[model samples]
Target: MNKITIFHNPRCGKSRETLKLIQEKVSDDDIEVVKYLEDVPSEEELKNILTMLGVKAGELVRKNEKIWKDNFKGKDFSEDGLIKVMVENPKLIERPIVIKDGKAVIGRPPEQVYSIL
Candidate 1:
């Protein structure tokens, strides 16, 4: 089986739930849980994830996040600029992104991971 990776924030309930759902469907060895808050994704990595998720950089942002609202809201950033911001502020990225076999989904509902799996 291919590796399944999840960009997880352990403190977030949705992230934790999504991780648990992935665990139920996949073996531990096949799963990689990323604590993105501590180990942020690079701009390039965020771009790749954006590709996998089939979304633009801004689409992956957690707009409701205080960091985004207080700092980045109402700003018009280029695609690369948004990606850079997400790299610098991982909290602005959406929760529980699951990726496998070149496909990805934002696991807001947790069940979304199944589509990629």
Candidate 2:
């Protein structure tokens, strides 16, 4: 199996569930759990992930986050700007993004991770 990478936030229920599901499907050594909040992705990494997910930078944002709503909501941002925002404020990034090979999926439903796996 290809190595799987999960951009995980342990505090989020969906993220935890997705990680658990990935754990069951993948070997321990093949699973790469990235606690994205503590170790944020760089701009270039985030852009690559967005490409793999077939989403724009803004589409990957968790718009409901307090940090986003207070600081960035209702504002216009270019693609690069949004990527910068997500890189700087990883909490605003969506939870449990699973990537394998060259594809990625946002695990909003936890089951969504299976698609890329």
Candidate 3:
């Protein structure tokens, strides 16, 4: 089996659900949970995960966040700029990104992680 890792924020329901689903599919030992807020990734790591997710920086953003609205809305930023925002404010990054080997999925409905598994 492939190594599984979940970039989780416990406060989010979708992230929790994704964790539950992974438990059903595999043993706990095989799944690693990264509490992203406490174990924050550097800019380079975040960029690599985003690339594995096959999405642009915008797609991985929680734009509804007040921080995003207050600072980033109606503004044009380069890809690097957007990534910097997510690195600086982890909340702005989308929840429940599950990575398996070289592949990754955003567990939006939680079920989305199933495909990558």
Candidate 4:
């Protein structure tokens, strides 16, 4: 099997749910949880992962976050601007992103992690 990485946040319901679903479909030892908030990805790494996800930087952002609401809600920025924000504030990155092989997916329903498994 390919390497499986879950960009997880323990406090996030979706992330927790995604992990549970992955456990059902894959072995526990095969699943690697990257607690992204604590250990944010490098800019280059994030860029490649975004390409794998087929989404722009802003699309992967948690715009509903209080920090976003307070500071970034009204701004209309280009892709670079959004990427900078996520780099500066890891909380801006959304939860439960599952990466397998060379493909990446957001586990919005949690079960989505199984699709690429």
TM-score of each: 0.96, 0.96, 0.95, 0.94
Model 1: weakest 10-residue lDDT segment is: 108-117
Candidate lDDT scores, in order, read: 0.91, 0.91, 0.91, 0.90
lDDT of 3 by residue, 14-75 (tens): 99999999999999999999998888878899889988998999898898999999988999
How would you encode candidate 1's per-residue C-alpha lDDT over 7-83 as one tens digit per residue? 99899999999999988988999999889999899888999999988899988999998988899899999999999
| 19-102 per-residue lDDT for model 2 (tens digits) | 999889888899988999888899999999999999998789889989998999999999999999999898889888999999
Displacement of the residue 44 alpha carbon in candidate 4, Å: 1.0
Q: In candidate 4, how many clashes are counted? A: 0
Model 4, residue 110: distance off in Å is 0.8
Q: Model 4, which residues run further than 4 Å from truth?
A: none
All-Cα superposition RMSD per candidate? 0.8, 0.9, 1.0, 1.0
Worst 10 residues of 4 by lDDT: 78-87
What would you estimate as the lDDT of candidate 3?
A: 0.91
